[model samples]
Target: MNPALQGLLTIIIGVGGCVGYFYFSNQFLDKVLFPASGPNAGKNINRANIIRPWLFLLPALLALGVYLAYPVVETLRLSLTERLPDGGSAFVGLDNYEQMLDEPKFWEALKNNMLWLLIVPALSTAFGLLAAQLSDRVFWGNLAKSLIFMPMAISFVGAAVIWKLVYDARPIDQDQIGVLNALYIFFGGDSPNNWLTIPFWNNILLMIVLVWIQTGFAMVILSAALRGIPEETVEAAIIDGASPFQVFFKIKVPQIMGTIVVVWTTITITVLKVFDIVFAMTNGQWETQVLANYMYDKLFRSHDWGVGSASAMIIMLLVMPILIWNVYNARKEMQ
Candidate 1:
């Protein structure tokens, strides 16, 4: 078949299949469900009423099941087996989980993940809130916001490389190479330090990379949320003698609590799954490993599929609740 005709046929069939499914499902629901459950027991029925909205929903539901639900199930199943070197394997029920629990590297990665979870979201949201509040009053606020948000446009690997140069170091005898170390030397510091080799602090340094990338996202969303806050509410608070700080705390924060949660949760999820920066900069070497990088090490570097899948499952398990809460909160807000 000609490519154009094939494409046309595919679209026609796709639309026909969707229309057919929605028409049948809507009929089934109205006949079986509404008669028994809905208040309209004796209402007139029409095909237009039955299938109008579901026509749009059919494609989305199908895509969700195909792209999201099926892969999750496959990943869960993959988590339970070990793949061997000679293309052979055996079932290992929780053995991978046991190994992961016993590994120091896994624990370190988990610890770093915890640190990321604690630090990045809080810092990003705090800084975003402050930026939002400050920008609200500035004359050229849009320009300032554009500048602040520009970092978010850089790829994670690019950002990591940029920061890598900033954190780069030279021997104390020689000139300090890294921007940070150079700044220190300029300030009369004695020696240059290897920033990435520093434990715990290195984790914080890695987190600053994420915060740099995500703060712009947080700022954009939060600034919009702040702008959405009604002038009447601020005026009312002022009329009742609320100080600026008091009004901000009691009124503004409470009003945008949903957006705050959203920003925090979004960054938290990103932090949990972070791999690119760590891999690009540290390659999970030194003390800079995170959960996603840990999983990558097991899956690819070590060829330990079971352990990798298990860690992937763990990440999914950690993220599912936040995702569920996000959905619930969004629904509640919409209602």
Candidate 2:
């Protein structure tokens, strides 16, 4: 069979199968669960009709269980077992957890992760808001928005590769190589510094990459929010002798505070799970490891499934509170 024809036939069959299944299921359910609900009890209670949409939700729930719930349970179980030499395992309860607490490298990774959480969201949101506010007062606002949002179009791995070249270090005696170090040397600095090898500064540099990528997302969201601010509010504030700063902080900010929190919390979760940039740039070397990097190292490099799982679980534990808060904030906004 022609490959294109085969693929088209497969898709047609799959879609037809789904349609048939749903139709049969709905008919069976209506006959079994909603057979007039004791005709004497109801002339026509609309209750059964209201539940038709829910009949279609079972497949989604099953998919969620297989993809999300099972792995989580398995990871938690793996965290308690030590990977034995012969591909078997030894159950060592809480040893991995205890070791993780005492390990200096773990602490360093945590510190870097914390720094990421602290810096990226604030800087991204600030830069985003600044760009958003500035874009509104311009003739080329769409152009400006496109430029600011361009970074988001790049994949994380691609962005990391681009920055790797930008931060690349070469011999000082040779022509300056990396863009940043080139500028540094042009300013009379002695040597091309290995920006990825420095301790705290490398973390900051990594944070800059995330901020660069996420600022575009922030800008797109916040630009909309800023535009949504009622002009009357700004005019009213100005009529009351309020300055631009006052109108921004007191009037515009108050209305958009929920969106800001949502953006912050959303990025905070990403920061917690960040592995690619650190992994690509430094491979969790030079104390620049975050939780995600640490998890990768434990699982793949050291082959310690237990510790890796514990590390992953710890990351999950840390992220849950923020996730709950984000949900609460979202609900409040909806209300």
Candidate 3:
């Protein structure tokens, strides 16, 4: 068979199989097993209802287990083992982690990532809240929101590329094409500075990209939460002589604290897994290393799976709290 035809057939069969499974499972439960019109009709129907959701969820659960759960387990195993010369693996326990800890670059990456975790979410949320409030009061609010929200739709790599020009450096002799340097020179600065080559500050510059992208996401979500605020509450705040700032920070914010936490954690997770921007901009140079970029370097660049997995596990550990919170929130909301 042609490869394309084979792939099409495979997809058809897989989808057909899932549909058939659900359809027949229901048929068996209702007709053969339950027979809901019988003397025990009520009990049979109750049993079928209890089983039905799990049956429908079976495929998704299976896929999640095999793809997500299994890879996680396998990566953990790899983190604890060293690949040997003859294609075998030997358990090295915490040796890989020790190796990573001993390295200066790993330490740098860790510190930088911690800084990113602290700054990105806070800044993104702040900017988002500002945009949300401002847009709400503007005549062309939707247009303003759309333009600000545009960055969220951009891929990280694309955003990185876009900002590359913004941070670009040129020799002192040539005209600076970068927006930052041009403004600096136009203001009578000595020379164009290479933004990404500056330590500590470079990390901040790189962070600007993530913030630019995530702020829009935060804006849209917080905007919705802001809109959902009861008009009566705002009226009451005004009646009490509360200032606009006080009304927003005290009345409006407290009401949407849960949504704010949701947005913060969501961005926090994104920051933990950040790589493409760093990769595209500085590639972890100039002390701008982040965990994800560090992990990629170890895994693929250095071909050291053990240390790589250990770094990945570190990221996973950092993400766990937010992940747990999200899961808890989702379950609570469901209830």
Candidate 4:
């Protein structure tokens, strides 16, 4: 077999299996095990109804445990142990953590990741909000939103390839190719600069890729939130001698703050795990290392499972607070 065919068959089998299980289990409960025609029919039916939901949910919970919870637990265990030279593993406690903390590259990646966490979510949200607000006023609002939101559909590697070309640099003697370099030369600059090779600025250029892709997601969500706002509120604000800026900032924005925070936290998670753009464009070279790429390098290139898993745990720790807050909000909403 073909790999694609095998995958298709596997998916078909999985779905068929789940459907068969549900149908047969429900039939068994209703007809054979707990017949609705029995003397205790009403009690049996109520019990069956309660148990049926769990029967359906059991497979999902098992899958989650096996696929998600298992890996996290295993990774934590691996992070606490180091592989010996003969391919044997030994418990090392916090040695891996100490080793990672000692590396300057890890620290560099940590700093860059922090900066990314701070900047990407904020900028992406801002650009998204601006696009959402402006596009709503235009006659071709849907078309504009479509164009703006189009980037979100592009894969990270594809987006990286597109941006790499945009940031490409050719010699001044030859025809300039990169847009930035071309613009630079056109405005009377020195030479075509390789943007990705530069230090802090290169990271900025890499971040711009994520920002571009994320802006559309932010825009679509915020646009919906904005649409949900009552027109009467805006009219009331206007009647009270409020400027457009005042209406947007004071009235509209306050109403949509929840959506904005949701967007922010959502993008924050993406930024924490951002790997593809940096990997495709720079590969964490020239002081541009981020936690994800660093973990990748440690796991594969250096063949250090201990350090890689430790880095993963760090990423998980960073993400935990947001997860808690989201769960808290969800529970509160339920109440």
lDDT of every model, 2 decimals: 0.87, 0.86, 0.93, 0.95
- The numbered model that scores best in TM-score is 4
Query: For model 3, how does the per-residue alpha-carbon lDDT over 1-335 read when each residue is reduced to its tens digit?
Result: 99999999999998999889999998998998888997999999999899889988998999999999998999999999999999999999999999999999999999999999999999999999999999999799999999989998899999999999999989999988899999989899998999889899999999999999999999999999999999999999999999999999999999999889889988998999999999998999889999999999998999999999999999989988877877887799899
| RMSD to native, candidate 4 | 1.5
Query: Total clashing residue pairs per candidate?
Result: 0, 0, 0, 0
TM-scores of all candidate predictions against the true structure: 0.80, 0.86, 0.89, 0.96
Candidate 2 vs candidate 3: which has greater TM-score? 3
Pairs in steric clash, model 3: none
True-structure lDDT of candidate 1: 0.87
Residues 171-200, candidate 4: write the lDDT tens digits: 779998788889988999999899999999
lDDT of 4 at 86: 100
Expressed as tens digits, the lDDT of each residue in 180-221 for candidate 2 is 999998898888899989888888888889999999889889
Residue 76's lDDT within candidate 2 is: 86
Evaluate model 4: give its TM-score: 0.96
Q: After superposition, how far is residue 224 of candidate 3 from its true place, in Å?
A: 1.4
Best by lDDT: 4
Q: Which of the two, 1 or 2, has more lDDT?
A: 1
